[model samples]
Target: MTGLVVPAAARVLSARELRALAEVAERERLGWNANDMSLDEEVLFFLLPYSYEAQPMPLWKCRVIAVSGGLPVEIGEGKRIRFGRLDVSLTTFRRLPVASRKAERQLLHWLAWEAAVASWRSVDEDR
Candidate 1:
């Protein structure tokens, strides 16, 4: 999957921005289905972009990786992994303000619905 450098200032920071960005990208990447994603993924889809604004990370240094079988983000303090600044701590990432709770909740609602639908479809496929 070719990577797109979504500029920090231009990154999806809010629910409105998330929906707008995701809708267009979803169309462009034919197989990239939000319904196939986990709740963690749905959150990270925006959080990854929000990292630039929240982590005080350099926009030029920011990058997003979109590949199947991605690993879970590490959650710990003072557990340096050699290249310290290269990684952004999600613990710190979540502390900053990004979107309104109402908007965030709504986005989550849509994701949860997607998961439910996917499960329903999967049940038939398993038969």
Candidate 2:
């Protein structure tokens, strides 16, 4: 049996956006960035906002898997790409809750932010 194939749109999260995420992470005080982390069931999954105009989405999503040398070596989703190892600044880590409901709320907020940004960009492009 052949599995159904779905065409997924590509998106990217720019360094600036990453910085924002980092700031959030840092505020949460996950650590001084890159402080070894353990892979838990709770992962930060960022959603990419759909846009008609093709602008590289800044880091589709980031997974807080591990921290090395104060750097977050986590998984990231890129536009039409899947990054196995990705890193974020201390700030991003701050926004992420190591283990709590706060983490889930933060994830939702991040997703909403991405969607809003994508929609805005698409509208701007049309103009």
Candidate 3:
């Protein structure tokens, strides 16, 4: 199935920013309908611009390759790999307890920060 990916150069948001994002996600989650595929896709789509300043990465057919250390890592050839967890469907998302959701948000933010650092290093290496 097609998936969204965060761009390599996307600025990893700071802790403060992440908190804000989580708040937004929570709000969205509150009103989300688990059975509505369109709404679910829209929520996922909403995150795209946050990570891409230039041309957005194309959606790709992808699969989760691993879930090491509680992070779901997916791969799609020729497509950017997003650091945050994007695989949680609305159905699954609604089933998660509030604490679990909070934890997930924190983990995602941390992963994004790490990805940003790695991306910066790669750019430096190219110089």
Best by TM-score: 1
Local distance difference test, each candidate: 0.36, 0.36, 0.34
**For candidate 2, which ten residues in a row score worst on lDDT?**
51-60
Q: What stretches of model 2 exceed 4 Å from their correct place? A: 1-99
lDDT of 3 at 20: 48
Query: For residues 1-127, what per-residue lDDT tens digits would candidate 3 score against the true structure?
Result: 7554533222233234334434644554422221222221112221212221121222211121111222333454121233232223333333333334544464456557667888999999999
Residue 74 error, candidate 3, Å: 24
Ordered from best to worst TM-score, the candidate numbers read 1, 2, 3
**Model 3: pairs clashing at backbone N, Cα or C within 3 Å:** none
Tens digit per residue, CA lDDT, model 1, 1-127: 7565443331223334334444544454411234443323323333434223323333222232222222233445111111001123344334434545554564455456566877999999999
Give lDDT tens digits, candidate 2, residues 21-64.
55654664422232333222222333222222112222223343
Candidate 3 is scored at a TM of 0.26
Error of 2 at 23 (Å): 29
lDDT of 2 at 41: 26
Worst 10 residues of 1 by lDDT: 77-86
Q: On a 0 to 100 scale, what is the lDDT of residue 68 in model 1?
A: 22
